[model samples]
Each structure stands twice: as structure tokens, then as C-alpha cells.
Target: MIYDFILVGHGLAGGILARTLSEQGYKLAVFDTFKANSASRVAAGLINPLAGKRFAKSWLAEKLVPFAIAFYQQIEKEFNVKIWQPLPIFKFFSSVEEQNTWMGKSSNPAIQEFIKQVHLRLPFSESINQDFGAIEIAQSGYVDVNKFLDCLLVALAQSHLLIQEFFEFSRLNLNADFITYKQDNNTITARKIVFCEGFQAINNPYFSWLPFSLNKGEVLDIKVDNLPAECIYNKAVYVLPFGTDGFKVGATYNWREINEQPSAEALTELTERAGQILKKRFVVTKQAAGIRPAVKDRRPLMGWHPVHHQIGIFNGMGSKGVMMAPYLAHNFVANLQGAKLEPEADISRFLKYFTGI
Candidate 1:
């Protein structure tokens, strides 16, 4: 079989990239291993407007948020699915100095537009220590990535473009012109191969040299009687309402040990941290862990392979895949369609590894 492009992995990067390329009228095929541990399935898909304890604006929030908002809305209408939700993160404040620092930064015209002047009074039915008010960060939300993947795979399958088997790395044949993979009696070929392997890319032969400071994130699923059903509550960890009687609370970002298994230590940490935040006691419903494809530089990595131009990558989204994928994917598809590349995400800047820059 032949296609204009073949995408490996069906997680956020692969799914969104495929959609963008398809929208631009590109003929593509997608191969997915459907690994249960892929970060997309385990993610809570929170899109935060601010980052760190001082409540600084996330990178490119002014531009990325608007694009993501419109993009998800269009997808919902086109596919008739509830993929995005507007959920405010009540960014927890720990110290008066920290609060004052943030308050000062919020006044900066550069960031003030994203941050609002408030007395720090926000409603929380549960009890959380708030000497100063929490910042009600707006234009922040989540995507039901799992649901989006399911619907997108089905949609692509209907078009005869999705294959469910795991992509075997040993069988991959990469050259300057094409990439091919074979399993059982079938073989697939395409002019270009892009690996959106998420954290698994830590093992990709081409991108291993990139500084991927991987971290393990663990989250909890719990059912409560009547918690804040609309807001994402935060103290040390975030309590995200998942509809019905349950909420998804997480996450512990640990760099010391990176593996795809939920640990009891994480469960205790999250539950205890959450217990201190919530006024009522909640039951732990589920626990899962996945490694984030985080980079030390903390940016999405997009570019053709250093040697093999026919190969490419769209990983290193870290925890912001929901927020970053649409914006970057659009650019990625555009570059493939004869558009110039964005400087920050362009991976060729690592010319030290290239034989020729």
C-alpha cells in the first residue's frame, strides 16, 4: 500500500497531525500500536493558561489558546463530539511573597492581559488554605483525548486509512525517499514517515540525542458525593471533575524514576494531598501512571530527521499536548504543504549532530 504520508502512533500528536494534514487535502495513512500505556490515554488533558508557582503565563498562551479554542470547536461541530471543555484552574497560592510576586507580574502589560486583577477570592465548596485568593485562570480547559482518539480512529478507518497493529521497529526500512514496515503478510509504504511515539520516542534511534528529561506522572480517579462539578480545584494537586460522581485528580511529576506503572507512594501522596484540599473525604476510584515526553528545554520538537529527510517527529509536548498540538500540528502540516517553519520548534537548530547544518 502507498500513501502521501504515514503516521506512526495514534496518540494526540498523531491524531491531530493526521487531521490537520487531511484538512489540507493530503492523502495519508496512520498506523497505531494501540499501547494502553501511551501518555495520551493516561493524561487528564488539562490545558493550563499559567505555569509554575508564581503563576506565569504558559508559552504562547495569547496565540495558542485562541487557535486551540477555535480548532476544538470546529472539530466538535464537524465530528459531533464533546472533545473540549472550559475548566478554570484555581491556581493554588502557597506564600504571601509568591502571591505578591505574581500580583506584581500580573500588572505587567505583557502578561496582565492573561492575568486579571482580583482580591484572590474564589469559591471552593471544599476547604483549601487560601490566605490570598487563587487566580481564576481563564481560557484554560481540557480535551477528552481518549474520546478524541477513538472518534478520530473510527473516522479514519471509515476512510481506509487506519491500521490497528503495533508498528514493529525492527521491520522499519528508512531511506532518503520512503519508509516501509511489514508485519505478517502485509507491507505498508509511504513517501514520509513521522513518529509521534510520545514518551516511547525516548528510544527512537534518531531523536535519542535530544535532551528528553522524562518524568513519570501518576493520577487518581475518585468518586465524591458533591464536589465542585464544574471547576478544577487545586492545592498541591488538581481535582478535575470528570462528570457523574467521579473526578480525576492528579498528578505527581517525578524525575527520579520514570516507568509506566502506578506506585503506592504516588497514590498516598495524591490522596493525602487531595484530602487536605477537599472539605469532604473522597474515595479513590482508580490510579494510573505514564511517562511524559518532556524535554529539558520544555518545547515541542518538530522537524525532519537530521539525516533522513523522509522521516519526521512531532513529540516532546510534555504535559501540554492538548494545548500545544493543534497550533504546532497546523504549522507542521503547513511546512509539509510548502510553508516555512517556525524557528522555535524547528529541530534542525541542533546542527552539532548534523553532518552539515
Candidate 2:
């Protein structure tokens, strides 16, 4: 049978894209091995509109946030599962000057949309230390990534649309009108194939030249007493409320050592940073690490190969996959249907890398 599309890697990008395309009435199949320590599984799935110390609005936050929320809600209704958790982000200020900086930006109309409230004094002084006050950000929350992906894979499996195995590049055969791959005793043919293999794309001979800047990030799950579970707390590091007394804290970035192995140094760093805001003692429950598929230019990578138009890529979402994938998937599907790809995200920007093409 000829499929409309074959997606490689069932991580966040591939999963969302496959679901998006399938809903649009496209015949498709997904190839993946459900590898452990993948970014999609390890990610906290944060959706924050304001980024950085200055609290500047994220690129295209106005559009991406609303679209993502609605998309996830639709997915929840379709799957009858709970994944999208809408919670506010309590961004604590470390200094008076930092608070002043936010006060200056809060008046801007664009920034005001994401700001819930500005607390001049410590809001939760008992469990938290807020000497310089904090800002409550609206339109922020987290997706239950593990639950979402697991549910997606199950739905795909039930429909016989998922091939649970490692994709072999050597077995792939691409043609002008279609592509074929040998799996076991049978061959699968599809009109187009998209590689969504996260950081592992660096090893892919076809799209490896796309300037991937991969980084390793580690996160920890801990049980803290008396910490507010009503919202996510952020200071040096973010302390995300989990179950009753549990909070997911993390994320230390390391570009030098890009592997999935959890290190002691990262554990210390995370605990110490989380300690700054979480004054209460906590017990470490779990630690995990994964590599982010980031790009040098800090934008998603999408578009067909310069020469092999039958081959395409939709990756490099970095840490913002939860907030960006659904909307990007919609746009990518639109591009496949004849619309122009978003210029910044279009791989055409790096056409120079495809030297011999």
C-alpha cells in the first residue's frame, strides 16, 4: 500500500505532526523505537510566553500560546486524557533592580497580556523567600508529555499505523515521486518521508549538515513540604508543582557534555538553584537527562531537502516543543498543501550547507 507520508521518530515533533496530518485525512505511518531518555519524555513541557531575565515576550507568543492551548485541549477531548495543565508561573525577582526592570516592561501592551499580577511584597513568604517581589505570568502551564506521547503511540498502534523499530537509513530508497524502505520481509512505500529524529539527526547523513547545536539538560523530581502547588515557581531555577507534595525541578544546560547520563554535578547545581527559592528541605525522588535538538540560529527546522524534494525535516524545537509543536505542525501541513513555509524556520535559509545538491 502506498502511504501519503512516512514520519521517522515518534518523539514530540513527529507525534504531533503525524496526528496533525492524519486528522487532515492523509494516510501515514510512523517509524520509531521509543528510545529512553529522549527529550520528549524528559521534558517538563513548560509553556511560558515571557522569556529571559528582562521578561521579553517570546517570539510570536501572541499567536503560538493561544493556538497551542486550543490544540492541546482538542487533543484531550479527542483522546479523553488529561495532559494540558493550565497553571500560572510565579517568577520571583532576585533583586530590586530586577523587579524594576519588570515594572518597566509590564506597561507595554504586548507584555501586559501575559502578566497576571505584580506583587510588591512576598506573596508566599512562609515557604518562599521573595526579597525583591515576583511577577505572576498568565497563559503559562505544562503538558504531561509522557502521558501525551504514550497515548498517541497507543492510538497509532491500535490503527496499525506505527512501526516500532529503529529506522535504517541504508535501507531507504528515495525516488522522484515516492520513497521506499525495507523493514523485515516487506517494503513500505510513501509519497514523502520526514525525519523528525531530534538530536540524533546529527548522525543522519542526509540532513546532518543543518547546523545542529545540541545541548544536554538534566531535571529532578523531589518531594517538598508546604510548597504551594497552585502555581509554578521560578527563581534561579523553576520548581514545577507535580503531585500533592512533589515538584519537578530542574534543568541545568550543558553544551560540552552532550549525553543522556545523569551527572552528580548537575544534581548539585539543580538542588542548589532550587534551594534558593524553595527554602524548605526536599528529598530527591528521581533524576533524568536528555539532549535538546537545538539549532545554531535558535529556530525550528522545516522544509524539503534542496535536492531530494521527496525528503523533508521537522525538528530542532529545543525546549519549547510543547508550546510550539502543535502550531508549527499546523503550519507545516499548510506548507505541504501549497503555502509558503515560515521563512525563519524554513531549512532553505541554510541552502549553502547543501553544497553538492
Question: Which candidate achieves the best TM-score against the true structure?
Answer: 2
Give the CA lDDT, 0 to 100, for residue 125 in model 2: 71
> Residue by residue across 132-185, what tens digits does model 1's lDDT show?
567667787788878888888887887747877776679888766777777678
Q: Which pairs of residues have clashing backbones in candidate 2?
A: none
| TM-score per candidate | 0.92, 0.97
Off by over 4 Å in 2: none
Clashes of 2: 0
By summed lDDT, which 10 consecutive residues of candidate 2 come out lowest?
120-129
Clashing pairs in 1: 120-133
Give Cα-based local distance difference scores for all models. 0.80, 0.89
